[model samples]
Target: MYETKKWKSKFFIVAFGQAISLLGSHGVQFALIWWLAEKTSSPLMLGISGLVAYLPMTLFSPVAGIAADRLNRKIICIVSDLSMGILAAVYAGLLFFFDLPVWTVFIMLCARGIGNTFQQPAIQSIIPQLVPSDQLVKTNGWMQLMNAGSFFLGPVIGASLYAAFPMSVVLISDIIGAALASAALAVVKVPELEKHQLEQEPIARQLKEGFTVFQADSKLFYLVLGEALCMFFYAPLSSFYPLMTSDYFNLSAMYGSAVELAFALGMMISSLMFSSVLKIKRKIRTSFIGLFGMGISAAVCGLIPPTYWGWFFFAAACVCLGASGNIHSIPLTAYIQETVAPERMGRAFSVLTLISSVTMPVGLLAASPVAEKVGVNVWFFLSGAIMIIITSILIWYSKMKRRHP
Candidate 1:
């Protein structure tokens, strides 16, 4: 119990630091999107900026993961934060001195994505070191809470800052937050794992090993496939929801705010449930149920007609998505941490990140065209349906294996 308490303390500290950093980053991102939209009035530009920011994580994650496996994970974290901070400062300078063009914003966003390619894998891999195996769910709950909080607070703070000052000043907040995150990491003491010293191995061989692990483990394969599909379909809500609410429903900016807030609230509530109330004998079963529920709620929200009543349903659906997502992610993360050897954690996380990154751009690209051709409502409906179908197939497969075995 004493050891558990100590681990919890460390976990909270790291979670807190990350929460702060994420809050600042999310705020800056939202503020920038709004700024660009107001300045250019072009959805295409916003889509381009989004693409630039996310595509690197998909492309570079494997390399970053290998670097994490071969080096000090803490150092990787520090370097990534510092690099991102520098980029944020540069963005501020551009906004201050020159009329920031679309290309410039895209370039800066790409730089940040490159930095995150390193940061995300290192961070995900390090969580296991900070908590006990049995406490993985609780620790993950806190992490989800931080995630939800960032989404909840970032946009409001960012918009407020942008209103009160110039974009340069607003961007400064991210720099400061990143610096603080680096400092927090510096102070934390984590048990160091031996770096993979197989320097003679080709990068291709190393990457192949990471993929081999996933391929060999049928459970992991299904889990990853489910995760990738969910990300691919679910990501569009972030890009298209504001337009949907404002244009389709003919609601005010307040409606967009409400939608975002509702989503965050759902996440927050679900995190709490996972930590405090929900319990399951089988983690896989719980994950399947959560994913299925999220899909169902999403589909229902899409099908409902636009009205005040529909807004409530949409908010409810958002809550279901958040809760179910947290339930699925916590176990998946813990399983990876436990199953992978310490030295390989970095590479494992990197591969996972790579899969996530690769899928997101595809998802975004798909969302825009689908929204244009069919309508955002249809897109949402189809995406949700896909999630449900995919999850059902995986779950059925898992059940058959269990019965046979």
Candidate 2:
């Protein structure tokens, strides 16, 4: 049994530690992408990099989720962080001595993605164990705030450090961050699954059980499918953010950092509103507003002129995109946490990840050629329009079901 009173303290400690690691992660990610962008200056190369970074996570989520349910969740997190730290240290050491090829970078990213595959589901599932049922939404909001803060600072710091020092220096921070994360996790006593809840079954049957649990809720199932489709458009555009700022706008990495900062700021503001001031009873409807808002904002981002003034407009749209994305994502997450059985939470989240993650890489691969040929902006415009159409149809369908039911 958990000490109810101490839940707040424990949750904050975990959140703080994760924030440190995430900050380092964001900085490293910015450095790597910017370095690659500077070196290749090709959309196709960037798309390929995104593919390598995300593919491992997508492929391994089912297994990872199973481990989270069966194994010691805290140990899984600690091992994952340590593994990533080892990878970072090795990468830093290699980069220190010699100029690593692009393939080497891809290998590093793939490994990191694999580590993340295990860490994410474990971390997400742990929250419900630590916090009370009523506080789940607030806790998730705080987590978002922590994430946004890291994102807000990471790119600017990464850009500045990369400009002054080597990429190796930026990566070293990840090792330190990882060590701290492991230390924090080690001290916390995460609850274990009861023997009855832990089924010693074959992987395929367990995987199918995960999907079946998720499929039990038809409304959430369809809504998740809708989110999956939106991701097909959103993911590629996100990977091309650097090109949109630097290549299309003919700006510097600092400008790219600023755009990212703007997005983070937007997330922070919206998270604060949702957690504190806003009382959203209708989660599904609110998520639709978020989805529809993101589509419109994305379209505006593509349509903006490639001028100094237009960059301001683009950044503004990004703020809305961030805000809307939070609105879209948080409620659904909270819904899952609230409704799903605790024993099955990890597998449930994994199923959600599987549904959402599969589309992203496909979209990246599909968009790479189109973006390379037509330009990054054209795909952004088209994706945004398609999202708008999708959202409209879903809204109508939702209304019709309400009336008919």
Candidate 3:
């Protein structure tokens, strides 16, 4: 059994290490996205970039989750980090010596996506093992805060470094961050779950079992589906941000970074609020409000004109977008951890990841050309309006079921 008294310290150690890793990862990612936006200036190219970055994870998450359930998760984390570091080193060299082909960047993104595929499930599964059951929500909130904080700093550093130095120099931070993360994870011991009898099962069976776990609970299943839909609408927004800031507003990368920072600030603020001050009992209610809020924010972003004031308003909308996202995400994740069986939690999360993964690509593909034809901002308006409609329907249905049942 794990020692309760030492859990907090252990958790913080892991959190600190992850914060470092995330900071580097976020910084490199910002630089790459800015590069892509400047290079192509095509919504379709941006869409493809998102696909390359996410497709590997989408494809492998189920197997990765199974591995998390059966293997040593700490080892998985170490290997994934080391591999990513090595990949970054190689890419950095190419950037230093020669003009790297854009296609190669997509390949690097695919490899990075695969690393994340394995690492995320392992890290998420480890959380319940470390924290007390009662404190799971607060702990998840803290995790979000750490992530948002890292992202908050990442853009500032990335923007400054990108403006001053070569891409190769910015990449060195990832190598160092990954090394530190590996070292930190190496020393900290994570408690392992007892082996399940299902260990004898084949991969296909295990994969199917992950899906069946949710089938047993209809509400949980639908909740996952509802969130999946929200992600579908939200996926395009990720690709559109740089475009909106640059092409639509005719702003510089600094302005784009400011918009990102605003979103991160909102995330940090909401994370602190929900994790500490607000003990929300009805998490579903909070999720509904979050969903509605995100829709409103997106619509408002679309409506903003191409003016200095418009850019400021756009940044403000992104802040609302970020806060609402956390409000929706944190509660639902906590609820899953609270309700799902400990042994099957990895698979549960994998299933959730898998569904979201499937929808995201489709969302990107469907929106890319259309956004290219119409204005990027116009798509944002339409997506947000549709999201509101969907949320309203879900809310009405949820209430009806409650009343009748």
Using all chains and alpha carbons, the TM-scores for the candidates as numbered come to: 0.92, 0.97, 0.97
TM-score of predicted structure 3: 0.97
- Tens digits of per-residue lDDT for model 2 on 1-405? 357989989998898889888888888899899998998889999998888888987899999888888888899899999999999999999999998886688999889989988998899989988988788778888888888898899898889889989988989878988999899888888877686435777778888877887578766766776788888988888789999988999999999999999999889988888777777777777888888988998898889989999999999999998898898888878888889887788888887677556777899989999999999989888889999999888888867876897
Residues 272-326, model 3: lDDT tens digits: 9877988878776787788788888998888989898899999999999999999
Global lDDT of model 3: 0.85
Identify the runs in model 3 with alpha carbons over 4 angstroms from their true place: none
Instruction: List the global CA lDDT of all models.
Output: 0.77, 0.86, 0.85
Question: Could you tell me how far off, in angstroms, the CA of residue 213 lies in candidate 1 after the best superposition?
Answer: 2.1
Q: Estimate candidate 2's alpha-carbon lDDT, on a 0 to 1 scale.
A: 0.86
lDDT of residue 21 for candidate 1: 85
* Poorly placed runs, candidate 2 (over 4 Å): none
lDDT accuracy of residue 68 in candidate 1 = 80
User: Which whole-number lDDT from 0 to 100 does residue 135 have in model 2?
Assistant: 80
Which RMSD values do the candidates have, in order? 2.5, 1.3, 1.4
